[model samples]
Target: MNQWLLYGVLALLPLAALSGFLMGRKHRKGKQDNRLSSDYIKGLNYLLNEQPDKAVDTFIDLLKVDTDTVETHLALGNLFRKRGEVDRSIRLHQNLIARPQLSSRDRNSALFQLGLDYNAVGMYDRSEKLFKELLSDPVHKNESLVQLLNIHQLTRDWDDATKIAEELQSSLGVEQSKPIAHFYCELAAQKRQDGDIKAALSNVKKALTINPDSVRASLLQGDIHLQQKSYKQAIKSYQRILQQDIAFLPEALPNIAEAYSNIKDNSGYRSFLNKSLDAGAGVSVLVELSKIIQAEKDDRAAAELIGNFLKERPSLKGLQRLITLHIEHAQDSAKPSLQLLDDIVEKLISKKPRYACHNCGFETKAIYWQCPSCKEWSSVKPIKGIEGE
Candidate 1:
């Protein structure tokens, strides 16, 4: 039922009772209020015939302005709003608010409905004010807070979003930590763009405090430390991601390696890569390890390692790397044969996606923390197995 219709029905209850009483009195006096009864029956007939427009007109004409009918008017207004008839909803709610017979609670209800109508029509400023008014009322506090939060989020008002999230958590036991952390991260990004590193760092810390498992927060922290030349701190932050969620290891690898290089700790980097490879982390770790081995050992050793690993867990990327290594070390007599092998492996690897969304099976060459297809967070990851790393 439409909110306006429901309000109208509720308002009609008292009028209905009065009409019945008057009819009874008329019957005792051998008289009848035939006009009022006829109009009521006509309005009901229109409603039963599914002619809502005619029913509304008849009901409005027949129904007297009273506390009982106020609720019916609100219900009808809400129904119109639900049907995407915002103009009608707005008029009905506005009419209810103008009535002096409405109680304080009913008046607020009407205002809230009007606010929703305004919001539906994209009159955000007006909706914001009405929602704010409802927020001040204890009875509607939770709903008002929720609406306010949505408004702030739509407006990109992160500060207000954060505050309202906190309030909702405290008052309604709603878990807002993840979204709150994201909001803080958004603020941090804005601050960073404005060259306010200190403020950005503060927001990042706040994000971490709210949700310790936030990968984006850790990534941002590592990036800030890296920019400031605090390699050890950067390494620590990036390494934390491995424990937090190993699926993000690929994202952390390059930064981790850069930090280790800054600190002149090639041995530590090698050890980490070896451990990751041993644990069957992903093809990325295997590739990174192969690169390290190629630098420290010979092409033959790196090729052997990749070949042996591929035999156990075959991957197109591993095969491609192996072919490339062989091509690099091949004698002039074997050069043509090695080049053919390389071309075959390259074609195979090129046909596969580099990244995929775990949530939606969306494939792309680029990585997205949030899946563009499904709009889910931290779902897209490097494609694994035979064709990808």
Candidate 2:
């Protein structure tokens, strides 16, 4: 649960306690002043005197575990945890679990809540142990697996995360293929960084097997092959991405063109660029094609093509390209002014984010398969607009 939701629960705790007290008013009160024990009064006094530690202890002692008060206590414990009072939540939940009169269901609930409290406090080992213990209970099996998966992800324990996610999928029928693929891709990336190319490829293959259309897997496969100087194989792997998602064509285009250049396949690269542009890929295709025109044809031809493209769809990147082409071809008398314009455009383009999260609107210069802000897979993509595309 998010801190905001916990704040609401905390706000409602007093009301929940009041309601519970009112509902259980006639039950074993024995005229004990609405069940506010002497210890509770003492705890309130300690709190008023600014002795929080003593107050917390006295309050815990004053809490009488009963059927009617269970929800109230749980709400308050959760509230404290959300308010960053994790120690209090821990003590409350722990004390509630230690009660011999608690029903089996309430006991399990307390355990789960306590696990969440531990997680909130960065006691991951304790949280993981509690969640693992919950796997035997059908009531919290899915939730426990999910929390364990979260903990493994936070620790970058991709192997453990994959195993827990697989169990979650099989046991709870939750959709996990996307994250599972990402986990394999993460493993592949780690192996690649460790200079274990073969192991990296093995993990990439596993990612594709789990999610055949995973763009990140294909990109990683192409990248590794390119790094190994397998230019033709790399081009083939990158070309396969067109069948998956066209939004990522720009991601593979530059690498594929570079691989083709290594193999002296300029015509093939140019031809593929034309095909992709004709299929309405993005401004990246237009920019690459314009570069080819400037090199093989002339600056005027390239400028004309880009100017016409801009007329149809004005883009910050395309305008920058146009300005750069002008600066390259300008006469000596006009060179300084055109170069200044190009610098301004470059600065503008650099300041604008190239990628953004569709889920959370988080913008950044680089691409991410999962949104860092929202932790959602396939939600961050290349920004599409006049400034980005």
- Which candidate number has the best TM-score? 2
lDDT of 1 by residue, 328-348 (tens): 667999999988888887877
Q: What TM-score quantifies how close candidate 2 is to the native fold? A: 0.88
If scored against the real structure, what TM-score would every candidate get?
0.71, 0.88
RMSD of 2: 4.4
Residue-level lDDT of model 2, residues 1-389, one tens digit each, is 46654554454445434643543564555545545555555655654555556755655555568887788789878877877889889989998999999999899999999999989988899999999999999999999999999999998899999999999999989899999999999999999999999999999999999998899999999999999999988987887777777678898887988899999989999998888877767788889999899899999999998999899888888998898888866799999988888889889988999888988899999998888899998888887879877
Candidate 2 colliding pairs = none
C-alpha lDDT values of all predictions: 0.80, 0.85
Q: Which 10-residue span in candidate 2 carries the lowest summed lDDT?
A: 8-17
Candidate 2 regions exceeding 4 Å error are 1-37, 47-56, 331-334
